[model samples]
Target: MTPLAGIKVLDLTRVLAGPYCTALLADLGADVIKLEPPRGDDYRHIGPFQQGESALFTLNNRGKKSISLNLKSPEGLALAQEIAAGCDVVVENFRPGVAEKIGLGADVLRKAKPGLIYCSVSGFGQTGPFRDLPAYDLVVQAMSGLMAATGEAGGAPLKTGESVADLVGGLFGSWAIMAALVQKARTGQGATLDVAMYDALYSMLTTSHALHFYADKTPERVGNRHPLSTPFGCFETADGQVVIAVLTPAQFARLSTLIGQPGLPDETRFATDEARTENEPELRSLIEDWSKGLNTEAAMVALAEAQLPSAPIWGIAQASDSAHARARGLVQMLPHGVLGQAPVVPQPVQFDGVKLMTYSPAPGLGADAAEILQAFCSVDAARFEDLKKAGVVA
Candidate 1:
């Protein structure tokens, strides 16, 4: 059986952060009921559609049942409350106080279902000065100093290629929910969790932030190189770019030998990690001079043979179609309704020495509404039809 087999999650979230968190729960075998708006999640309109289905939506929202509802309606709100009352967890990403204003807040639902794990994912958390401010992933990234710490030195601060701010929030939200679930199992009591994109991104600045207080040094963007580690950055070879991380003295010694610079390490400038970091420009130029003669593959293999951590920089298509990705089943062709078989990245975790089994595709915009209302809210065919007629449920 799956780890979360019997857990049921009432998901009242749209877009990235909250939906991604619930998707993780659903992947672990939680019966996630996605309570979408009547118009569907905003991600449906995002570009790069397949057979009229949003690729972004499908990638993040697999393995969940959809039930669209007009939460503005009293009847719809009441039905949502009923679902929350019976669910093991309730996840929402509405701005702070919006859930409470609509009567679906954690306080009300956790009181009704005493053991429920209620998770709120927001840009600034539920009780912060910026709680009520409207924010997207970009805003949070900039505010949390993540964007400021990216890009090349003296270059314009660049946001990450992916929506790291949103993903971080979702990851932390799932982790917090899982912890709360564990606590509930132990004490038979519920817990409320607040996951913020700003906080999540800030917490992930482990090295950069730690340096500020510990050494009175503010982090600056240094492109692909690590903040402190020497010889830990991308290098260009004859064919393409490769990354080599000589993280320890042993690795550094091995790298020097592999690059035909054995005597260089004995120099004071490149002897230790601290000295090498202080002289990274000269070190990087020296390594690149050697790499310029060898192709990327050859350089990578030589580095690997020397026991240094190194790899060629691969584009998304290359990485996705690589042998290792296929061997590990990192990507799969899943049936996403009219989209047919589409490639999706499933949950990366392994349970009991085996990969978690994947479930069904994301529901086609409330495709399970009638079934869900009938099953949970006890709205039979005629009542469900009436609610649909009244535009209460879609």
Candidate 2:
């Protein structure tokens, strides 16, 4: 049996962060019922669609059932509260106070079922000064100082290539849910989780934030180089780029010998890590001068011979098809009935010598609405039809 076999999650989230959190729970064998509106989740219309289905949506929302409900209607709100009371977890990413206005807030649900774990994912959390402000990944990235610290020195600040803030919020939400579940098991009570994208992104800036405390200065973008360590960044090769990190003195000495600079360890300017960092420009130039003569493969080989940690810069295609990633089953193909084969990112967990396989396709809009109503609410065919006529269940 999977770890969360008996858990039930009512997923009222859309887009990325909240869906991602519930997706993790679904992967662990929780019964995740995604609640969407009549038009379906907004992500359904997102790009990378195949055969009129959104591949990006499917990639994150696989292995779950979808049911459509219009919460604006009184009947719809009542139905949502019913599901909330029955489920072990309810996750939402709506703006602050939205759930409360809809009558499905934590206080209301907890009164109905005190053991319900309600996780609210937002841009700046529910109680912060910026709580009610609308936010997206780039906005949070900029607000949290992440964008300021990224990219090349003296270049325009850049957001990360991916929606790291949203992704990290999802990861944090999942972790918080799991921790709450553990606590519920002990105390027979539930907990409310407030996860903010800005907070999550800010929390990830561990070492970069630390520099301010240590040196009384906020960190500046230093391109690929490490702020504290020397010889710890990407170097340009003849054909491409290779990143290498030399942490300790032993590694530095080994690197010096490998690069045909045997006396580099004895040079005052390059002798110690502090000295090398103080002279980073010269250190980077010295490494690049040697790397300029070699291609990426040759540079990697030389670094490996010296027991240094180095790797070629790989694009998504190359990394996805790489031997290491393939061996670890980081990518998998799932059969999506109409889409034929859909590629999905596997959950990053292995348990009991087994990793769970993706078992369901992304649900067609409201495909399981009738079935869910029947199974969970004990609603008969007549009642379901009545609710549909009343413009509640879509």
What are the per-residue Cα lDDT tens digits for candidate 2 across 101-184?
A: 889889999889988899999999999689988999989999998888888988888888999999999999999999999999
- Where model 1 places Cα greater than 4 Å from the true spot, the runs are none
Report the CA-based lDDT of candidate 1 relative to the real structure: 0.88
State each model's CA lDDT, in order: 0.88, 0.89
What lDDT is obtained when candidate 2 is compared to the true structure? 0.89
**Lowest summed lDDT window (length 10), candidate 2:** 353-362
**What are the models' TM-scores?**
0.97, 0.97
Which lDDT value does model 2 have at 389?
94
Q: State candidate 1's TM-score.
A: 0.97
lDDT tens readout by residue for model 1, 1-394: 5888889899988899998998888878899999998789899889688778898898888998999999899999999999888788999999899999999998888778878889999999988689888989999988988888889989999999899889889999989988988998889989889998999999989887788878899898999999899999999889889999888888888888877889877999999898999999999999999998999889988887887888888789999999988888888777766877877787887777676745688788889988888888888899888998999987
